[model samples]
Target: MSSDLWSFALNVYARPGVEDACLRLQTAGANVCLLLCGLWLEQRAVTCDEQRVSLLRTLTEPWDAEVVQPLRTLRMQWKTRAVDDAVLKGMREQIKSHELEAERALLSRLEGVAQAWARNAAGSTTWLEELAGAAASPNRDALQVLRVAATGT
Candidate 1:
């Protein structure tokens, strides 16, 4: 999608009423990697069919996409051996780097969508709740939004 369209979609998808859409996308096999893409489409109030949404859901699930696949690929790339301390340390650093890279990519995409919502001064409690639901773990910002939504402050 074009950058403008992508930005627009992110804002719409991050709105309060998009949980159902997110769930639908998750169920459809869309990767959590493409969360920004989904959020963008959602922000635009775009709707996907039941089949498509289901496919996206499958794609994003931990078992199918994010955690397991990366681990599997890593396992294949490295040899599991009883190495000395220095080698083990280097390997550990490499693994950490890989994990960090993956996290950065995922967060970058999600943030693209979330930044739009975060900039808004006014949004419904429902939008906050949806954002909390859609956010990955450690979603401090979404939690804050939820708190604001709850107190109506």
Candidate 2:
């Protein structure tokens, strides 16, 4: 598996069931980028703590709200109408690609911050769960799928 967040996210997300799981979690209000970041940090043995979790949230929430969400909303809004209009469909595809690029940028930014955190051999990380917060219970199975796929266990 790749070590960088973007590459690791691509590799893990390509695993069977991971895409569905991530979508499910995303629908449940979890930030998919943060979830991927959590998985990356956990694999590196970075300790999970309230401060660290808060920092990740602080970095992610605004970017997601201001950038990714708007692109997603526009893409989704075009779904039905785009089907019947060729031009709309082309624009929708472009928006979808832009959304992906925005997410990749988020992951890169996350990696930059996370790389400074030292990994501890004895540390236990629950980044996925913590980041998922309230959504963790409802999307437990989906979250587990991510964990399994991320760790290849």
Name the best candidate (by lDDT): 2
TM-score of each: 0.33, 0.96
lDDT of 1 by residue, 45-110 (tens): 444344434444444355336654675356445545414456755775677677646644554544
TM-score of 2: 0.96
lDDT of 2 by residue, 29-72 (tens): 99999999999888888999999899999999999999999999
- Predictions in order: lDDT: 0.44, 0.92
- State residue 67's C-alpha deviation in candidate 1, in Å: 6.1
Q: What is the lDDT of candidate 2?
A: 0.92
